[model samples]
Target: MKRAAELELALAPRAEGVTLQRWLCGELRAAILAGRLAPGCRLPSTRDFARQQAISRGTVVAVYDQLIAEGYLSGATGSGTTVAAALPIAAAGTAQPRTSAAPGIARAAAADTAGTDDAATKRPRLSRQGQLLANSPFLSREGMVLGRPFSPNQPDLGAFPHALWQRLTHQQGRGLRPDDMGYGDGAGHQPLRRAIAEHLRYSQRIDCHAGQVMILSSAQQALDLCARLLLDPGDTALVEDPGYPGAARLFELGGARVQGVPVDRLGLCTDALPTAEEARLAYVTAAHQSPLGGTLPLERRLALLAWAEAGRRIIIEDDYDGEYRFDGAPLPALKSLDRHDRVIYLGTFSKLLFPALRLAYAVVPEWLAEPFASAISLTVRHAPILPQAVLAAFIGEGHFARHLRQMRRLYGERAACFQHECATQLDGLLTVLPITTGLDATALLPRGSDDRAVAAALGAWGVEARPISFYGMGQPAPPGLVMGFSACNEAAIRRGVATMAPVLESFNAAAAGNRGQAVAGV
Candidate 1:
């Protein structure tokens, strides 16, 4: 009796919007359905059941009476309530469970009911990582290859200069030395590194020699490599509270403890940085704080440098989308001002040249270059040679610079149109973030709204945008959308936002109704 009571207590649901009687009844039913509470298994007395569940005696009696009435169990004045003998049970040695099917079998059953064939039924289950990556909320509705819906972080595939890329590839390929096809330097192909160095100096005002540059697959990979080189298990790293999920996840996965420092208009609140004992690395997006679009003030930049110097902590500066500043002339990258070599500068070509390129580079300080080079050698050897050669040709031939200039002008015009449409159409319903330095656009909607549901509704309307909450580590995120406008033109931007407006209104109304219910409850 004591063992049965313990099992009942262990299986009980936590109190959440459910009466004790309702919870107990549901648990008992689930147990019976799952075959854990076998048919003919007798339930404890009402008083004992109530004691085990920490509920009133009347609640248990009510639950037992309900189950008995439902024909799931039987009871009498003296005999305890027992699972009914007629309840479904698996035949001995049968593959299927007696009552309900397992997930795989259930899915197969569902497919069969829908007339799917055996070939479809035998499909493998999606791995946890695969499922997570596939269902990432960042995916959009416009760019899916199979015409299903857009996947988030998808670049404007139509905009890629494939013809020019192929031409450049052929042009570079014709002159490739036999050794160029052989194992190259792990730091990167020299010409490509030199080209990146030159581009950074000319465009971003960051002066780094080719030796300091190391090519990696993407910004996330760069961060992961940095984490491996710099962090040890249980070491602390500071991250912006509402910052990049990729960086935060990588740091946590690398066995490093992460502290979420707050961010304001001027970027990461340096004053809020944990004490030296708490943190050894600070990851920042100073050129444009993601989702907020606020550039770190020059004063704060200097303060951060000083803090890093004093504490001997390293700064991983993710200069993602730094080239597309629409407001004013671009600010110098933090690496340009790092006389102490404490900054590991990361930049990506994904936003500019299309994400499919998978090209990004990190500028390591001279002292760390050798170890980083060795790390690269041990890991990915070097970036693919052909892309590097094509990029080098793109830079050397001046196409890259011209492309940046052209895109800047186009993005500026589209951004203006987007802002105008938001102001005109949304009016008081939405607030657009002021700065537009990056390839992305952000707008804050009213709090308490379901941004994910709103984003999904907009996707159904053929417009894709990411919910601002998707970027946050946890809840209470400000309601907003982090919209990528570079791939979309003015008309597309206006149409997308227009489509999104009704969804936003529906969310706002639902939120208001919820608030009303809460107030009435109070």
Candidate 2:
């Protein structure tokens, strides 16, 4: 009957990408909790379970090993894997542990299971905008968990200079004044601002002084601040279709009417932008469009500036992946071409370093600098001074530049290798899009399909590819997957693609079969 239960587990809604291992893990755990698999119950041997389920032995072994690690199962020499003899699940209304259980482990299990009861408590009311942001499917649920392979926009964290960073952080900490430890300027640490200004002026070709730079936690923070300060409750904001969701969400939260302007291969369609007097703020990633990886041409950039100047409108240029373009000379930041001081340049160290760094900056015009600084003060006051100081030193010395140079090369190589694998292994299965910038690239399905489900299936296969539809706020979006190469090594990319090939091939076969059956009936 247990063998029958294992086979039954295999049949449950697996089309949602419930892998054999995951289903078994969930089922076995549920059984143990419900007392179906009693304490000390012997689980089937890996070989036997795999035979019953018609799945690979490795999956069963993996499930067994994970359960052992999590204390839901136990294994010992000569003793087969067994349900943990004393699970820490409490009775309906009690917290007392079973007397026969291992000490400490029972309490740990009880606490883990207790979270469900806590969650079942009543929820609080949220504001209208808060509800919109929360219920939006585009919003990310990934919080604090380590990123998986092939996740988009992820940097090669393994390449970070940890020892040097630790040294810099300690050195900065040891020298902080009482003022530094206490509340500080919202604009930023003056030294870090000066360093950033100098770096941008010389490297990014953005001419600005330290006074014009306002430091924030991330580019998302910068976007939210700008929207709050600039847009009224009902002002219209122009954003790129298939653009970064965080920007659109922040603008919506500010009670602004967001219009998704269409984009093409060359990036945001400037001609399609609302006429000069209609909108106030335009959020554009000119260096590299978020999902599509297109660089707005110099002509288009000039036109955008002219449009902004004519209307006295503001442009927020998010140069997130500008430094990672694998093709052609890197173009100057949009701020570099600003003659009317209408562009607010936003940059972040998250991509350059790691996400945990929590440091980003915005370059405002001289007239708005004071107002921007005041707003930042009211918001989060300032980023944690310690990391800011460490980053400032990292840039002040040549380490930052050297790291960027090395990362550019490493990402370039990884991109090339992944592209090569796609060409050789997935030529007919997926129409790989041309990639020039960003940590991830796009690939189209041969036909319109449920990319969301496909993306979920790919995730189950240990691959990461965001559904193209996930990036769209407007209707009639394209169907594809945004596959990332930066977080993984060449071998992982290769292995992930290999795992994907059969799934895609099976879909193609089924689609063909359906068409054939239709034609025969017709």
Candidate 3:
């Protein structure tokens, strides 16, 4: 049997602020859990320990009684005290002294850390879908905080009506009903939905009612819901070859087999539509094709709708930056031509108002309305009601329309500035495509020059641009840089293009040298 003096010598120093009884109980428990005090080992008698510590015997007895009750030890009138043969719980592994800067904890801590890695390895791995989503571009945390020069798809944050928006938000908050603060209608605020429907009718010429619209946290979330609700593993989904990578990644994460349909200067090649029997759905940015900036011609729009209707397939039309088109009149949305209700029109305030709003809407067919609402409830509960209410007021009061007009003028001038600077500084080095619509301008690199390397080089010099190859989805896309003008002012656009001139020249020169080497080898 271990003596009271020997046990006391092994105990760690007690901490401050803990009761004496707790300190003793904790040290004993730690010792037992750490396996330093072997199972069934005899313990010192309470009376003896009390004498050793110069405390009342009652305190020692109380500690012993509590530990025995917790199944850490066993005691009876004649049994003397002993550690339990069977513990009720797994070893706590290691522990710190109760609220004290106690010595001797280092040994126990070492024991704890030794098992940390082993314990982690024993845990289950991420599911296949989870692993795919984890590695997908949609979930990437890079380039999310955009405001860097020439970043694509970002709106002019500086030109947004912050004061007016704040006023509307404050008004809505003050006037909110008690019900407004609770979980909102899963379909979203009725007034906001109505406002959106009316806005679409006027701007995009889409014939939708408030009942068909469901507000969501973002266009991405809307697509996620669509994927979960409509797609099963191995379903064939078609997206533009040089299209939005986020959409393709989302469908892939949902276990859909995503195929890239080639995009030409006029957008998705209607003649190249995969047979109706082949694809289940197609996602398109018809108002302005993403990254490439092509507007789908009316004939192709009709052809796409005909194919979807004939196949009973779905078409997701993302009218992301339709309001900012500078070329002629903005074309009617693809949904406006959907005679068979196959098109789901997706729109977002993130691009129009600001990204932080995180508000977007989906106008689905009547058949999907209820199911989509139910899905929204399961996925996000509902988009916050207060922002919805404020947006409703903003649109209803004509502020949203006014703001859109202001942005159109502002972005138009910036786009012109961007074009002029590129023509002046980069005429020989790069081909600057016409910016007919959308926030970004796509400039093609010389053939065989690596756009990705150029993009990386630009980042080092404090400018940002997405290489077109990133959106190519393993297919061949024209190598280029997508430089956004919407987020930058005229002066910033000039400076960005000026900075880009030398970088592109260097890459072009390098490509020429590489070509010369190839010819010499031949």
Candidate 4:
């Protein structure tokens, strides 16, 4: 009866494209690899298997014969149809335990009663990597959302020179050679790399040749590649507390143990870093820290450099929004101060040009250039070529620099206005954090406050805000909200907050009343 039940399960179909025989083979193979079937276990007789599955006896015989031939099953003189005890995959790998969590399982068991809604269905089973992506808190799920106040990771899309960009894209498309339209160099097009190298040298005071640059679709991609190449499963990686959640998720998915180091007004505390050569890589946003917006100070930067040099460790310096500094000339990038060649510096056009551009670059040590290129080749193979060409032209023609100059002045004004509004309207509830640079600033909430609920309320009222606690990976987090001022004008900021302050006030009053009632009962 158990054998019959197992046969029925193993032959049941999923998604209708493949032939029945092919699906049977796949199901059996996956069961073996996932360890649902143990080595030396006997499969049902071909006639019995056919009877249970309601398939042809010949079909069952062919599947068993194929499994025997491929070493998935055994047909030795004494063994009738036993699972192979020494399968090749089992020679090098072991099975996952049944106790593992099932994150994305299936819909059939619930189909009849639960209807067609996804939440009503059984969750599909996900692999270890897919499980991490499935549970990510930082990634936005909204598609085609209309722009609103205080959106996270937003840039001033309205200020972009759309007509000029369209013209440049059209111009580049016209000039593409037959070869240019095909898959490009995975390391990126030569002209764009050269353009980026020059742009970094002049703008961020970092030195690198075009050969040292690897272009990717986004900074998040760069983070994934570094995690894959530099660290192995269970390898330790140090990340900033309240760091970019996208990076934390990638590192975890890559099977790295990400340790969170606390960040202060200056930046990541170098003293808190591992003392005795432990972490394989450290990810930092030195130019403009993501949510908190603290530039790592010079002395701390020096200490971090020394720490990396001492352990021969690698540091990923994400300068995603480094260009729009309103304070005195921006501090020299961490890459500029590195004497040991251990820093991989990242920059993105998404914040500068626009997010839809999906272009970012990393300047790496000479030793990693070829290996990094090969990795990119094996993964995405190459970023789409036309956009790379257009951006190279845009930077070469001086339009990118001119745009930066304009955004710097504009964002500084918008940020000041945001601060003013938050102070006057939500002063007792939320305090605006220091804002020297970056596209957004944070508003710290009262201790123990629920920032996610507040952010949801703001969203319901047509404002898009991110809960500040979402960024921290481990340890207790202070309550706050990350507010993007670059994307919205002063009028929008004031108007949104005007509506927001009253809602927050009423929520606070109700919460106070509940606490008072509880105290009186006690």
Q: What is the TM-score of each candidate against the true structure?
A: 0.72, 0.75, 0.81, 0.76
User: Compared with the true structure, what per-residue lDDT tens digits does model 2 show for residues 142-231?
Assistant: 621245656877888888999999999899989998877888889998889999999888778989999999999999889889999999
The candidate 3 region of ten consecutive residues with least summed lDDT is 94-103
* Candidate 4 residue-wise lDDT, 421-477, digit = tens: 888998897888878897888888777678989888878888777887778777566
Q: Local distance difference test, per candidate?
A: 0.76, 0.81, 0.84, 0.81
In the range 423-459, model 3's lDDT, one tens digit per residue, is 8998988788888787888888888878889999998
Most TM-score-accurate candidate: 3
User: How many clashes (backbone N, Cα, C below 3 Å) per candidate?
Assistant: 8, 0, 0, 6
Residue 421 displacement (Å), model 2: 0.2
lDDT of 1 by residue, 392-480 (tens): 88988998888777777777876787778888888777888874676667788887667777777777787666777776764345888
- Candidate 1 is scored at a TM of 0.72
Order candidates by lDDT, high to low: 3, 4, 2, 1
Candidate 2: count of backbone clashes, pairs at least 3 residues apart or interchain: 0
Which candidate do you rate higher for TM-score, 2 or 4?
4
